[model samples]
Target: MLLNLYGIYGNFPLGKNDMIDNATQFGAAVASARKALGLTQRELALAINSGERFIVDLEAGKPTAQLGKALAAAKVVGLRLTATGTPQA
Candidate 1:
């Protein structure tokens, strides 16, 4: 298990009130999804038409720097994006 920080985990089943933390959950989710599918960061990045560095950033939950690209990459990795809270109807 790769632990990024004191509270951050690098893989699935999230943890302790998980998604409540932040987009880190989303990023970690994407990374976990990709790994489960048996793909490397370089492969995922290529599939997303992005650079490995960007994918690394996204997986690291540093998305505040590039959200659109991160989401695009996430989509390429076959992960669906949805609003956590209630969407305005």
Candidate 2:
């Protein structure tokens, strides 16, 4: 339930759709959350039943990484993504 207002990613205000604009931002957030939880990439991968390479790519912000696995990793690390309707102008 960490909400970083200054951009470490959790619950920060985003663009119109509230979606992260790029993989680098997403990856940094994931890495930050993982570290905050004191879990190593390999440990998180094992906990989430994913491969170490997947974790590496995820932390590196690989744009084409599988959404399912990425979401799963985020969950294990306590990161939550939500969707909202387009913001009003």
TM-score of each: 0.65, 0.72
Residue 63 in candidate 2 has what lDDT? Answer: 97
Q: What are the clash counts of all predictions, listed in order?
A: 0, 0
**CA RMSD of all predictions:** 7.8, 6.5
lDDT of 1 at 71: 64
What lDDT would each prediction earn against the true structure? 0.63, 0.71
Model 1: colliding residue pairs: none
Off by over 4 Å in 2: 1-19, 87-89
How displaced is residue 18 in candidate 1, in Å? 8.0
* Per-residue lDDT of model 1, residues 1-89, tens digit only: 12221123324444433343456766787787678667899998887677898888788887474777776766665555434555455
RMSD after Cα superposition, model 1: 7.8
Query: Which sections of candidate 1 miss by over 4 Å?
Result: 1-21, 84-89
Strongest candidate by TM-score: 2
